[model samples]
Target: MNEQYPVLPGAEPFYAENGPAGVLLVHGFTGTPHSMRPLAEAYAKAGYTVCLPRLKGHGTHYEDMERTTFRDWIDSVEEGYEWLKERCGTIFVTGLSMGGTLTLYMAERYPSIRGIVLINPAIDIPAIRAGLAAGDELPRYLDSIGSDLKNPDVKELAYEKTPTASLLQLARLMEQVKGELERVACPILIFVSNEDHVVPPENADIIFRGVRSSDKEIVRLKNSYHVATLDHDQPLVIERSLRFFAKHSK
Candidate 1:
């Protein structure tokens, strides 16, 4: 199993500092903590405790993703939240794509969160549904598929095979979370792309309308795809997130 599932390096034992505010960074679906590591390290360097936990079934075998559910992903975020809550007076959640969805869900469920930063959040699965309807489904376990983990400027990083079952479950979770969006009262900063091929750009509008947070802002990235965290807008993402943290961490 170990040979079939070669562990991705640089992700292990979550790290952080005991402080007044904590920043939690989460990566997208079928992605490892490495996706969020740069931002995590940036936050840490700025003197805030940062937690970048590997989501359930990710950073391991793709077979493990098939065996996991959306609830399992949420549980992992909750675990990270609890860990951050212990050493910090305020907690801020941030994520990319599915990680963004998890961050929204966390804000809705836990009012203690001081603020939120969402990067190309995936709040719907219409494309996945369309693929299912077309009967073009992918495999449940594609552990051997190679990743596009290279230069973001020249190439896009994504899973070779998107699991149908997992995507279906994610759709359901999004629907449930949408209903609770109005319950979130903290400040929210959303980063979206004008040309994200994977997640529809309309999701930004949906999130903006659903969220009850009065202190909310959306920044559009004109030269990026869905994974803006690793795309050309990465520097902007880091800077904006750090600014948000500084504003609310006090």
Candidate 2:
């Protein structure tokens, strides 16, 4: 299945010179590196060495997702960041949804990170809060749903059923990331959709308020859905992300 998925045009042998700066892009849960391929390519084209690492159990069988944990996701991002750090003078991390959360975790753990960009970061799971309160009920329901499923989009990609355990672990990680937000001092650019039906817009608000970074901005995408990366507002996302990268890369 991994071989069936399209690889990014210049994704392999990730190397670049005189690039904008090193960029580490992480994709959302149940998503592959494909989600961030365009942005990665854009950064590379703009002269930045970009690394988009496939998270644990991703880009493969749906069942592989069930066996992974949030720690594994964070570790993958860390590894990518380390790879970028060696080649570039500065480093910026970006993510979508769960990817966003992992970016925040990286920021908290690595002070050298120059900046961060988050698209609809999942800081809390309001939809499953009650079930979580009921002691494993949410995990049970999510396990039934599988990791491959996702909200409908005009340019829908294949999604596996979400694993219950993985989602519950994500919820826990969100809480942990929320608590660690105060430790993130890097410049940040966060994007949110006014009409997003998945992660709540409030998640953005909490991040905007909690991040200790003196340089932080949030842009609200009025016409976008949950997956703003591929939605009509994608141009704005790319533009803003580049702008943010340029600002901090200096």
- Best-fitting candidate, scored by TM-score: 1
lDDT of each: 0.79, 0.77
Report the error of model 2 at residue 249, Å. Answer: 1.4
Taking the tens digit of each residue's C-alpha lDDT, what string does model 1 give over 162-201? Answer: 5667777678778888889899889999999888766788
lDDT of 2 by residue, 95-171 (tens): 98888999999999999989999998888877666666677444433432212213344443324466666677788
Per-candidate clashes come to 0, 15
Error of 2 at 205 (Å): 0.4
Query: Where's the lowest-lDDT run of ten residues in candidate 1?
Result: 142-151
Candidate 2 stretches with Cα past 4 Å from truth are 1-20, 135-158
Best by lDDT: 1
Alpha carbon deviation, residue 133, candidate 2 (Å):
3.0
